[model samples]
Target: MLKINLQKKLQRFTLELDLEIKPAFTALFGPSGAGKTTSLNLLAGLTKPDSGKLSLKQKQFYSEKQKINIKPQQRNLGYIFQESRLFPHMTVKQNIEFGFQLLTPNSRKFSFDEIIETTGIVSLLERSPAALSGGEKQRVALARALLASPDYLLMDEPLASLDQPTRLSFLIFLKSIYQKFNLPILYVTHDIASVINFADEVLILKEGKIVGYDKPMRLLAQLQTRPLAAGEDITNIFKLEIIRQSKSRGITVVKSDKLEFVLPHLDLETGGELLLNIPASEIILGITEPNGLSASNILPGIIENIYHLQERVLVEVNAGEKFTVEIVEATVERLNLKKGTPVYLIIKASSFRRLS
Candidate 1:
């Protein structure tokens, strides 16, 4: 476990944090200037706090009163910044070896070959930083961090620089790394979509204060009646098992713990999983069942809550698995939708997008 109780006085506001992170993927979610990066810096010993304590597995990393502060390299915490921050003078192989050489053989948890293979950067090892693309550079950086054999890893929007498709792919790759190594990670990002289907628990930060911490679904449920963040759409993301596929029907069937979804056909194996993203704006809600329609999926549920956005209203529906449906205020009033209003979600089979 990692414990942190730190206070820092920044120009905008004072950052006061009290958190206990377990050995799982925990996300620090917030908008710009929420002090998410500052919190990570404090934990990594890159910055000193005005007061408080920091410890990992009963080892003290910092103590303002005790005048104890561990050096950044000595903390055994790997830090991946927003940029790749690789050395222009070195090749990818040399850059990765820089971190590996810092530790003795006994301290290394993974071999250099293992890190390169796991990150899929073996081919790029001889390439220089200037020759690598955004995603490739991030992969090399990840390999460098893994070679350090750190107790915990800190990622600050490492995928933010990648394009949408590359970012989604990297997210899936990161999930596999977490599963394979079972290492603790504190991932920081402003995009809720990046963490919705990624993190085990989300720690919401607002103006240097910890606003909420819980499972992603439960945390969103608590914020159902209000906007979780400005200028961000609420999307329902799920990782479901592929129960079966119908090549004849051109459809695939997948199921969550409680609900089944019919999606457009994909050439994937049975029992494999797919990461699906259902945008709130793409879902249509109806107060009554309609007759013949072109849509393929319709789910019955009650209106759990309502949130009023600047232009559109977001409705929370409990259809076995909770779903967020977007609609306009005029439609909400026209359909007489409120808490406990029974409704059906109309979704086309092609509306589902595969993230991984």
Candidate 2:
């Protein structure tokens, strides 16, 4: 477990942090000048706080009252930044080994060879940083960090410079890292999609203070009014199991935890899982079963909660599977909707997209 309570005065606002983090992949998210990077610096011992306490299990990093502060190298933290930060003169193999050399003899959990194979950099070992692509350089950086045998990992927008394909590949690798090490990870990024797709818990910062922290969907719910820097709706991201697929009809059957759904099929294999994204604004709700409708996908569920927007309402439905639907306020009054009311949902096959 990791704990923090720190205070710092930035140029824009005063930074106050108090958080208890478990061993899970977490994202520190906020707009510009919200102090996400500063928090990471504090964790990595790259910056000192005016006053606070920090601890990781049996070890202590900072205790202002005690006048005890650990140095950066002594903190046993793996830091991956926005840039690759690889040595131009060194080959990929040398860059990674440089990190391994930082580890003390007693702290080496993984052998040097293990880090190389795990990160899939064996083929690039002989190549210099200049010869590698942007994505490849980042992978080398990540490999170096892992080899440090750190107790925790601090990543600051590590994928910001990569293209879509590279970013997805790196994300898959990130998930594997958690499963293999079970080390607490603090990921800082401004990309809403990256947080939604990767983070198990999200910490939302606003005006230099933590506004909210929870699982991705709930955190997004609490921060609904604050649009993502890019105005992306990071809602209703589901990992659904594919039950059956019909290539001829271009439809697939999938099962959520509670509800089974029929959706337009993509080129995905059956028996595997796929990421599905349904924007709240696209989900439609109806009071009664449709008498005649062009949309073939209709689900019956009960209203679990209702959130009022400026002119729209977000209706949360529990159909064994849960989902959020955005509808106009006038519809709410017409249907006399309230909690526990059974509502039918209409989802055009085109509305939901397959993420993976």
Candidate 3:
């Protein structure tokens, strides 16, 4: 478990953090200028907090009032930034062994061979960072971080640079790490797609304050009924069961209760369950059901709730699962969308993301 209550006077706003993170993986998520990175820095001992305490697993890492501030190196936190930050002069093998060599022989939690095998970097040990691809470098960096046997891994956008496929690949490895190892992880990422797929607990920050924190599903449910932080609407996650497939049209049909939707073809079993996201902004609503529409998904369901935003209205429709749709305010009045009013939703095949 990690407990932190930090406060610092930044140039613009006072950066504050008061969180008790017990999950193996906690995601620090928010808008670009929400001070997410600053919180990570404070946790990693990179910045000194004006006042508060930081501790993880009974380890008192920082305390401004008690006059205790552990150095970054002494904190034993394996920090992985957006870049690999591997040594250019040394070979991959040397770069990986750099941290392991610093630790006393008795403190080593994993052997060199174990890390090499676990990270699948045996073939690239003799090569340099220049010779490695972005994904390979990240793998090597992960191995190096693990070699130190850190209590927690501080990953700041470790997969931000990688493409979707590469991100998916590393996500598997990171998920394995989260499951196999006892170490905790504080992952800072802007990619909400990745967050919903991997994160257990999500911390929402606005300006410099901790706006929200909860299990991903619960937080998403909360957002469905109301806005999260700074009028930000959460994306919609649906657990759909693939009922059939069409090779000619290159699409798969999924069903949830009475509603049926079609999406781009995915390599998933027809009878199996798949998780996908439809961003709230992508949905188009209508009061009357129409035919001959290009949209692959058009289903009718009653509007359970409506949240009026600045210029838009977030309509929560029960089209099988709770589907949150963001539409213009005028459309609300135009359609006479009151609670319990029936409505239809039109979404394109491209709007759905198969993150699984």
Candidate 4:
């Protein structure tokens, strides 16, 4: 278990965050300058709090009363920054071996060969950092961090510097590592997609203060209460089961308990389950069925709740246990919607964002 009750005042922002995280991967998510990095730095002992205590598994790393402040190097944290800070002059093998050399032979928690295989960088060992692709370099950097035998790993936007394809691949790789290692990870990212797929729990920060910390699905469902992106809409995740394939349209027909949707060319096998997101603003609600509609999908559900925003109304429609739809305000009144009102929801196939 990791517990933190820390307070620190910066020149412009005062940071106060109190959180207790279990032994699972927790993500720190927020906009830029929200102090996510600062929290991680404090945990790693790179930044000391003015007053408060930090502990892991009941061992006090920092306490104001005891005046116990551990140095950064002694904290046993493996930090991977946004950029892969590999020594350009050294080969990948040398870079990875550097940390292992610091540990006694008997005390090394991970073997060099295991680290290399875990990160899939065995072939790049002899090459210099300059010769590797962006993803390869980041993989080598991750391998180097794992070789350090740290108790916890901190990743600050590890895929931020990569291109779209590289980022996706790296994310898949990161997920595999998370499953295999069982190491406590404090991953920092501002990307909602990353948070949805990677985070076990999310910590929402706004201007150096914690606005909300909970499971990702819960936080995402109540996005209006949290500090979300300006003009950005909420995304509703749905559990979809592939029903059949439409070869002529090059799409896959997926079904939930209350709805059926056609998604573009998914590679999922029949009967496989997948997660998808539909933007709240993109959904349209209607009291009666319409004819000759261009929309490809429609579902019947009852309004579970309604929220009035400054400029929009957010409606939550329960579409069985597998799915929910969030529709905007103007349509709510235009359709004369009410709680428990059975309504037909329309969604375009293009609107569904597939989440792995």
Q: TM-score ranking from best to worst?
A: 1, 2, 4, 3
Per-residue lDDT of candidate 1, residues 1-356 (tens digit): 99989999999999999988888999888879999999999999999999999999989999989999999989999899999899999999999999899889999999999889989999998999999999999999999999999889999999987766577668777888988898889999988666766789998898899989997656665553454555355567777899999999898999999989999889799999788878888998998896798888999999987866555677879999988888898998898999999999999988887877
Which candidate, 1 or 2, has the higher TM-score? 1
Better of 2 and 4 by lDDT: 2
After superposition, the stretches of candidate 3 with alpha carbons farther than 4 Å from their true spots are 223-356
lDDT of 2 by residue, 1-356 (tens): 88989998999898999988887899888887789889999988899999999998889999999998999989989999888799999988889989688667777878878888888788999998999988888889989998888888999888888765456557767887888888778888877655665788998888889888887756665666654444455346566799998889988888877766778877677889876767777887888898688775798999998866456567789876777787778988989999999988888877776666
Better of 2 and 3 by TM-score: 2
Clash list (residue pairs), candidate 2? 258-320
What alpha-carbon RMSD in Å does predicted model 3 have with respect to the real structure? 6.3
Q: Per-residue CA lDDT of candidate 4, range 77-190, in tens?
A: 899978889998899999999888988888788888888988989999899999998888889989998988888889988888776445655665676688888787888988
| Per-model TM-score on C-alpha atoms | 0.76, 0.75, 0.67, 0.69
Candidate 2 colliding pairs, count:
1
Better of 2 and 4 by TM-score: 2
Clash numbers, per candidate: 0, 1, 0, 1
TM-score of 4: 0.69
Tell me the deviation in Å of residue 160 in model 1: 2.2
* Per-model root-mean-square deviation over C-alphas: 4.5, 4.1, 6.3, 5.2
Residue pairs in collision within model 4: 313-329
What's model 4's lDDT at 88?
85
